[model samples]
Target: MQVRSLVSFLALAARLMLLGGLLLGGLAALAEDRPWLTAEERAWIAQQRVLRVASTPSYGPFTFVDAEGRLRGLSVDYVSRLNELSGLRLEFVAPEPFARNMEALRAGELDLLMSLRETPERAEFMGFTRPYVSVPVVLLRRVGSERQALMPGEPVSVGQGFAAADFLRQRYPDNPQQVETDDKSMLRRLASGEIDAAVMDLASATFQIRGEGIGNLRVQGDVGYAYELGIGYRRELALLGRILDKTLARIDAAERQAMVDRWISLQAERSPWQRRLLLAAAAALALVLLGLGLVLLWNRALQRQVVARTEQLRIELAERQRLQAADHARALAEAANQAKTEFMSQASHELRTPLNAVLGFAQLLGGDAQHPLDALQRERVGHIDAAARHLLILIEDMMTLSRIESGSLAVTPLPLQAGPLLRRCVELARPAAASAGIELRLDEAPLPLAQADPVRLEQVLHNLLSNAIKYNRPGGWVQVRAWAEPARGLLIQVADNGLGLSAEQLAQLFQPFNRLGRSEQQGTGIGLVISKQLMERMGGQIRVESQAGQGSRFILELQTS
Candidate 1:
C-alpha cells in the first residue's frame, strides 16, 4: 500500500512541473510583446483601457473631421500607428474648436490633446511627448499683393488658437490682429480683401486653398515660425506620456515620411491639366536659360569692342587737340611779327623825314657864307644840328631792332678776322671815349677767326664801346681783349672800370626798356637788347660779369671755323 502512494506522488510531481513551465512560458511571451511598458505602466493602462484625445476641429491635413464626420488626418494616422504599436486604445473625442479642446484638456475633461504645441503655461497642467510632426507657418495674401512683413495699424488675420497667432502678437504687437475662428476663416478674410494678410501653417493653408477653391490667394512667404506638434496629456499621467513617447519613437522615419508625403504633396492635389502646364513651363524655362547664356556671351564680346573703340577715339581726340594748339600758337606768332613790321615801317616814314630835313637845314645854316654870325649864334646852330642827329640815330636804332625781331634783317655769317674788326670798332668809339674823359684800351693779343655776320658783329661791338664810354665816370678805363679756347672756339671781352651794377640791377640789365634806374643816362635802354639778339643770330652768346662798386665786364663767345 505504501509503494502505491509513492508512484502516485511521482505522477503528481511531473504534472505540476509541466503546468509551472507552461505558465512561465506565457509570462515571458507577454514581456517580449510589450517590452516598452513597465509592470506598473501595464497595470495603469489596464485600469484606464481607453484614453480620450481631442484636436482642433477644422485643422486639415494634421487633424480634422471629414465631411462624413470620420476622424481623419496626419495626427489620426499617427494615433492609429500608436495603438498598433503600443496596444493602447487612444479613442478620439468628438471634434471641437482648438480653444475648446485646450480648455477641456486644462479642465481635466480630456485625457489627451493631439497636435498641440507645448508651452510653459500649458505644461503647468499637462505633460507632453516628443514632437512627431513639424510644419512651417506661412503668410497668405491676394495674388497680386506684395507685403513681406506685417505693418503697424494694418489688420492681419490669424487663427485664434494657433501658435502662429501668439508669434505674431509678440513679433508685431503694433500690427492690429483680426482674430478669426480658424485658418479657414482667416484665409477667407484674406481672399475677400477684408484683411491685409493671414498667418497659418503651410499644410492647412495649401489644403484649404485647394479645397475651398480660393483661387485669388497665394502663399506670400514663410512667417519664420513653425509648429512643433506633439501629444499633450494631464500632468499626473506620466505613464501615458512615456507610452506615447515610446510609440512615437517606434514609428520609424520611413513610415513617417510616407504619411507626410501622402497629405502634404501639392502634386498629389493638382489636376491633370495643371501637371501638363507645369511640364510645359519647365521646358520653356530651359530654353530661356540657354538663350540667356548665348546673349551673355554676345554681350561680353560687344562690350570688349566698345571699350577698344572708345580708347582709340580718345587717342585720336588728344592728337587732334595737340595739333590744333600748335597751329594756334604759330598763327599768333606770325600775327605779332606782322604787326611789328607795320609799326616799324610807319615810324620810319613818319619820323625820319622830318628829322632829316631838320638836320639838313641846321647844317646849311652852320656853313652858310651869306649869313656871317656871332659865336653865340654859331653855337646855337651847332646845338640844333646835334639834337637833330640824336633823333635820327634813335629812329634808326628803333627800325633796326624791329627788323631783327621780325626776321626781316638778313644775317650772313662767315669765318672773319677778329683783330681788324676790333681795331676799327675801337677807332670809331674813340671820339666818344675822349668826350667822356674815359680811356679805351684794346689788348694786343692774337685772336682766332670767329664765325659771325660782319656787319652785325661790328654793330654789337660799337654798341658795347658806346655804353662803356657813356656810363663811365671821369678817368675810368675801358678794355677789349680776345683769345682762342680749344673747346669754346673764340672769346672776346669788353670790360669797363666804371659804374658797376648791383645784384638787383643785374637781374633787370637785359630787359628791353629797363634802365636799372639809370634814366638820367643818355641811352635808349634797347641797345643791349638788340646787341644780345644779333649775337644769338650769329651762333654766339654774350654774358656780363659785374659787382656793385667794383667794375663791369661783358664777354662775347663765338664758334670758330
Candidate 2:
C-alpha cells in the first residue's frame, strides 16, 4: 500500500508539471503570433483564397529566404509584385522534387510554380506563360582556359555533360566527343591543360571568379542557348493563369533587370554579425590576459553575461558564414554542371551535320558490286572525300577540345620572330584575297619581338587575315600589321573593308560554332575559336572593332617577352 501510494504521487506530480508548461507556452506563442501587417498586406491577405505556390529552394537570387528569413529575390519579388497587382492571396509551399511538384498541381494542391524552363517536352504536362527573362546557357571556364574543339583538329577542349551531350545530338550527331561526370577529375584535367573550357551559367561565373581565385575563367556567349523560363501551372487552372499573366506582364523589362542587379548585389553583402564576432574574439583574447581581474569580475552572474556575449558574437557568426558560403557554392556548382551538359549537346549537333553527308557518299563508293562509279561518279566521290576530310578535321577538333578539357594532350613549343610570321600569314592568305579581288597588305614597321610557338602564332594570323578577306566586299582591302610599344605587349592587327557587325554580333564573334554569316564560306566556324584559344595560351589577347557595313578591325596583343 505504501509503494503504490508513492508511485501514484510521482505520476500526479509529473502530470502537473506538463500542464503548467503547456499553459505557459500557450501564452508565449500568443505573444509571438501578433502580426504587424501593413495596410497593403492586410488587404491582400484578407482576400486570400489560399493560392499555393510550390518552388524549389536554393534557386538563389530567384526565390530564396534572405538572412533575416524573409523570402526575397527576383522570383519572390516578382511573385509578390504579382500578388499586389492582382490582389491574389498566396500561400507559399515547398516544391516537391521532380514530378511530384507537377503532380501536386494536377491534384489541385498547388496553383502554380513560380518559374520553369519552357520546353516542348514539358508542354504536355503544364501550361506556360510567355517568358519575361532570357537566360542563355553559357560556357563558364577558367578565364585562361582554351576553347573547346568540335572535330579532329588538334586543339584545346571544353568539358562535357548532359547539356553538352544533348547539344551534340541535336547539333553535331556525326562527330565524336568524350563526356565527363566527375568534377575534381574535370578540374584536375583542365589544370593540366587536358580540357580547355567548362560550361557554366552567366551569373554563377562571377562567384567562381571570386571563389576559385581564377583570374582567367570567364563566361563565353550562349552556345546552344537554353530553354525559356516561364511560370508553370496546371492547364486546368485557367482562371488563376489569366490573373497571373496580367500581373506578371506589369513587372516589365527594366523593372525585372533592376531586381536582378539589386538581388545580386545584396547577395555579396556579408552579415554584420560576422564582423562583430571578430571584434568580440579579439576582446576575449584581451580579457584572457587579465586573469585575476576577470575571475573576480566574472561571478556566476558575470559568467552568464560573458557566455551570452560570446554566443551572439563568434559562435553564431561562424555558423551563419559557414551556411552562407555553402549555399553560394552549391548554387554555382549546379550552374556549372548545367552549362557542361549544354555544351556537350551543342558540340554533338555541329559534328553530325557534316558527317551525315560524308557517310552517305562513302557508303555509295563501298557498294562495289551493286553500282560501281564511272569517271563522273569517281570525280564526285573525290569531292565527297575532300569534304569528308574537312568534316573529319572538325570532329578531331572537338575530340581534342575534350582531351584538352580532360588533360590528355600536350603542346609542343616552337620559337620564332613576330614580324616575319605576320608576313607569312599574309602570303598564305593572299591567294584567297586575290580570288575575291581584295588586297592583302602588311602593317607598317616598328614591330617588337615575341617569344612563342611560331606555328601557333602563324595560325592566329591566318585566321584573322582570312576572316578580313572573306567577309569583305570585292575590291576591299585587308591590312596586317605588328608593332611593339613600351608598357604594352606586342600589338598585331588585321583590318578589313568588310560587311561589319552590330554590337551584338561582335559580342558573340569568337564563340565556337557561331557562324556569324561566314557560313557561306567553306568553314567549320571554329577558326577564330581556335585562334582565340591559342593566343590566350601564349599569353596574348584578341579584340575587335566593327561598325555595321563600315568595316571591321581585329587587334591582337601578346605579352612581350
Candidate 3:
C-alpha cells in the first residue's frame, strides 16, 4: 500500500508541474504581443507627476462632459486609452470660453490639448501628434429654408480657431463681419435663424443633430477642405512627443475603428418622431433636387445655344475686321520701308561729297613741299588733315554698315600666315601706342596659318588694336598673344591693362548704338558690332572678358589650314 501511494503522489506532482508550465508559456506570449517601454523611457516618463491636459467639453461626440459631470467623448476616451498604456497620470482641465485653452497652452499652463487642428499660428508653440481623425468641413442651414445660396451682406458663421474660419475669410475678404463662434453655439444659432448658414465638420454636425436633437438643421454643402484632428502638446515636451507617438503606434487599429464606430452609432441613432420627420423631409428634398436638376439641364442647353450664336457672330466680325486691318498695316509697312531706304541712300551720298572735298584740300595743303610753311602752320595743316581723315573714315564705316545690313558685304577666304599678318597689325598700331604713352607687347611664337580673307582679317585686327590703345589708360600696357588649339586652330588675344567692363556692360557690348554708358569715349558704338560680323564672315569668333578696375582680354578664335 505504501509503494502504490508513493507512485500516485509522484504522478499528481507531475500533473501540477505540467499545468504550471502551460500557464507560464501563455503569459510569455501575451507579454510579447504587447510592446514595453524602454527602461530609460519609463524613467523619463515617471518624472512627470501629472500632465495637465486642456479640454473644451462643449463640442460633443468629439469632446464634451456629460450631464453627470463625467468627461465622456471620443477624444476623452482615446486619451484615456493612451494614458492607460503609457502609465502617466493625466489630469483633465477645463477652461471657460473655450478659446482660453489655447491661451493656457501658450502660457504653459496646459501641457496637452485634445482634438485640435494643426495650423501655422498654433504650430508656433505646440508640437502635434500624427493625425488620429479626419472629418469633412461643411455648411449647414435650417431645413425647408428657401435660401439655396448666401445673399450678399448676409452674415455667415464659422467655428472659431478652425481652418474653416480662415478659409471663409480668404474666400470672402470683402465681408469682414462673419460671426465667429464654437460649433455647438453656431449650430444652435443656425437652427434659430440667427445666421444664414454655419460652417462645421460633418461629424460634429451629425452629432449635434442626432445626439443633441439639433434636427432643424441640414447640411447645405462642404466648406473648403476637410479638417484633420490631432493631439497638440507644448513644444517643450519633446519626450512627450516620442512617448505618445510610440504608444499610438502600438494601439490596435481595430480598437481605434471600434472607437470611431461607437461614436458614429451614437451620432446616427434618431428617435421615432425624428425619423418620421426626416423621411418626410427627405422626400421633399428629393423632389426639389429633381426639379433643380431639370432646370439646370434646360438652362445649360439655352446657355450653350446663346454662346454658339454669339461665337459665330464674333468670328464673322473678327474675320472682316482682321482683313481690313491687315491690308492697312501692310500698306503702311511698305511705305515706311521705302522711305527708310531712300533716306539712307540720299543721306550717304550727300554727306560723302563734302567729306571728299575736305580730304582732298587738306592733303593738297599739307603735302605742298614747294610752298613750305613754318612749324605752327605745318602743325595746323596736320590737324586739318587729321580731322578730314577722321571724317572720311566715319563715312566709309557708315557705307560698310549699309552694305553689311543689305547683305552685300563680300568675303574672300584664303590661307595666310597668321604670324606676319598679326606682326603687321602690331607695327601699324605702334605709333598710336607711342602717342598714348602705352606699352605694346607682342608674342612672336610660330602661329599656325589661318583660313580667312587677308583684308577682312587685317580690318578685324586693326579694330581690335585701335580699341585696345584708345581705351588703355596712359602709361598702361597692351599685350598681343597668339596660340594654337585643335579644331579652333589659332587664337589671338589682345589683352590690355585698361579700364575693364562690368557684367552689365558686357551684355550690351556688341549691340549697335550701345556704348554701355560711355559718354567720354569717342565711339559710334557700332565698331564692335561690325567687327563681330566680319569675324563670323571669315569663319572665326571673337569674345572679350573683363572685370571692373582690372583689364580686358579679347580672344579671337579662327580655323587654321
Candidate 1: tens digits of C-alpha lDDT, residues 1-561: 899999999999999999978865664555458865777766555445578888666788878778887878888888888888876789898889988888888888899987788776787899877666666676778988866455667777888766777788776788778778888887887888888788887778888888788989876555446676789899988878877775665665467778887777544357899989999999999999999999999999888865357788899999999999999999999877666665674456458757867988888888889987689999999999888887787787787776566444545455577777788889889998988899999995776667776667888999988888877899999999998989988898999988889999999988987888987886778889999999998899999999886779999999997
Q: Which parts of model 1 are misplaced by more than 4 Å? A: 1-32, 266-561
For all predicted structures, in order, the TM-scores are 0.44, 0.38, 0.42
Best-fitting candidate, scored by TM-score: 1
TM-score of 3: 0.42
To one decimal, what is the Cα RMSD in angstroms of model 2 from the true structure?
Answer: 21.2
lDDT of 2 by residue, 1-561 (tens): 999999999999999999978865664444333232234343333444677787643344456544576665566777777766555666678634434566676676787776566555555667766454544445445555454323333222333322334554554566445455423344445545566655433343343344344444444433434434568887776555545554554554457667666654313434699889989998998778788666776686556655357557888899999999999999999767545633543465346545866777676695676777788887877787777877776775564454334322223222235665566667889898999999888866865456454545666777677778878998889888778887777788889879999998988887878887657777667777877777777677788899999999888887665
Q: Given candidate 2, what's the lDDT at residue 14? A: 100
In lDDT terms, how accurate is model 2? 0.61
Computed on alpha carbons, the lDDT of every model, listed in order, comes to 0.79, 0.61, 0.75
